[model samples]
Target: MEVKKNPNIAVSRNSSLYFAIGLNVMLLITWLSLEYKTFDKPDVLLENLTLIEEFEEDIPITDLNMPPPPPPPPVLSAPETITIVEDAKEIEETVIESSETSQDEKIEERIVEVSDVDVEDIDEEVSVPFSVVEEVPVFPGCDGNSNDELKACFSKKINDHIIKNFRYPQAALELGIYGKVFVLFTIDKDGNVANIKSRGPDKMLEKEAERIIGLLPQMKPGYQRGRPVSVPYSIPINFQIQN
Candidate 1:
């Protein structure tokens, strides 16, 4: 035989409704508390941004990903280089002359050369005219033989002497320059060359003319009234180009 056990259910249909309301209120309060306390739990471990997040705790995005930013660009400053050069220069020289007094600096006077005159001065005498001393011989020393032939012969001789000795200045010929040379001379009673000179246009030619004049030979002495007399003469020498 089955023992009959009494079923003990304290909630009755009328109280069931009140019990359900209380239970529902309790459930709501529990859910709210759990949500405030544990619903937001996340990972707190630092991690690489490249790695996947698999934890249930809170983790900051900043903490996980940043690479450091590249170490603030390395502090830098421009480098400096120096250049040096050596230069050369020339030195100038100065000279100072000794100072002298006016008197000390004065130059000495030059001496002058005076040439002697080549002619002799004659004395004049006054006399009463006497019978021309017989007109004796004025030509041949007291013998009045006026020899025209002798005069002509001497003139010819003088001409020959000049023609034979006349010379052109060699220096001028070598230099290819030419000119005329003039000379003044005196022919005494004894047809001789005297007071010879060269007053030419050029120095060399003048010298040559003088030389020729000096080379003249003596001639027969001339007579004027039985006495030798001096006579003036001239000579001309022409220079020309040589072959």
Candidate 2:
């Protein structure tokens, strides 16, 4: 008896769950049937249309009158008469005689005798030796009463100039270069120094010596035989580097 009472209670507990499952299955079947159904579409009709418009208005027409171009000008006529005259004469031609000497004539070659002329007296330029110059070049600020004294004074002034303007090149000093450079320069007739030449054991020393000599001021030109002449002067410069 107790087991029979329990059968209804077990069936009642599962009845609500089975009803929810059946309701969900029915809703899914209805959605699938609606999705798979096909329906016919309505036909669309189209017709072509044309519109006509008429406009009436009066338009005025005008005529154009043009004149023709002018005719060409008349041509000119030339005279048809011509006259002729004839004259006969002899033409005279003048004859010219040439003064050129013929090859048969003896050609005389004259010898030009040039006397013993001093080179200094001529217009030609020649460098005069310092020793033979009648008047030595006068240096600035050097006082002398005679040519000999002036030459000595010039020598002294040259030494003083070298001492005042001597400068050893930095590169030469760094290399410890030591030597004596002989610089030869010319004093032109214009009293300006020109044609500077230098010789030494090292090129740097020679160049430095030439630079110092070029800085010499303009002086009186030397004279040879009472005429101003170029004087060639040479001097020696020594370079010594101190440790």
Candidate 3:
């Protein structure tokens, strides 16, 4: 046997519809509450209200005492008009000689003697290495028979000069700086030592080496091909601490 109930009396028959309607009503109430706004009403007194008129101040018209304009500039006299006159003297036209040779022109065939040409000797500055110079620079008090002997003497003199002038820099000695300085100097054609340069481990050592080399006396200029020439010489100076 099947039991049947009436739809109006069933509790869960329209539960979804009832829930949907309740949810819509709640959403409408929330929207209305959120959209509602209140403003404060300020109290206004009709007696305190007044209309203001814009007032314009009248400034007095006092005339400013300005200095009178400077006197008119002096009138300048007009320059005399120049009158053009025709020159009566006849002008001589300058004749220009043409340097371009024509085909019919003959070239002169004069004999040029070697003796007729004057030769000027220009003393040009030439530098030569000390090793290959025909004649090495002669140091003072060095007398030798040949170039080899002169070179040996020169070396000996340089060594002696260095030994005589060698003074260890106090700063370098205190700093424990010691090294060999390569000194390059040029013996100019004037027999003077010039362009002294040095390279070492430290500036103090190099400076000391340069100072010693600067004391070298002027030497006889080197010779190359029967002409005096500048000689470039390089030597290493050892700066050793005795300690």
Q: Against the true structure, whose TM-score is highest?
A: 3
Instruction: In candidate 3, list every pair of residues with a backbone clash.
Output: none
Tens-digit lDDT string for candidate 2 (1-243): 354466666887898999999999999999999899687987878777776778778787777667787888878788788755445655578889889988999988999998997666457786888888888889998788888899889999999999999999989888888889999999998789999999999998998998998999999999888888999999989898776
Candidate 3: residue 51 lDDT (0-100): 83
Worst 10 residues of 3 by lDDT: 83-92
Which residue window of length 10 is worst by lDDT in model 1?
A: 128-137
How many backbone clashes are present in model 2?
0
Best-to-worst TM-score order: 3, 2, 1
Q: What TM-score does each of the candidates earn?
A: 0.35, 0.49, 0.51
Per-residue accuracy of model 3 over 10-38 as CA lDDT, tens digit each: 98988999999999999999999999999
Which stretches of model 3 miss by more than 4 angstroms?
1-121
Write model 1 residue lDDT over 122-225, tens digit each, in one string. Answer: 73321211112112112221222435444444445555766788666667778877877777776555556577877767788888778777886664344345
TM-score between model 3 and native: 0.51
Model 2: lDDT of residue 161 = 93
Between candidates 1 and 3, name the one with more favorable lDDT.
3
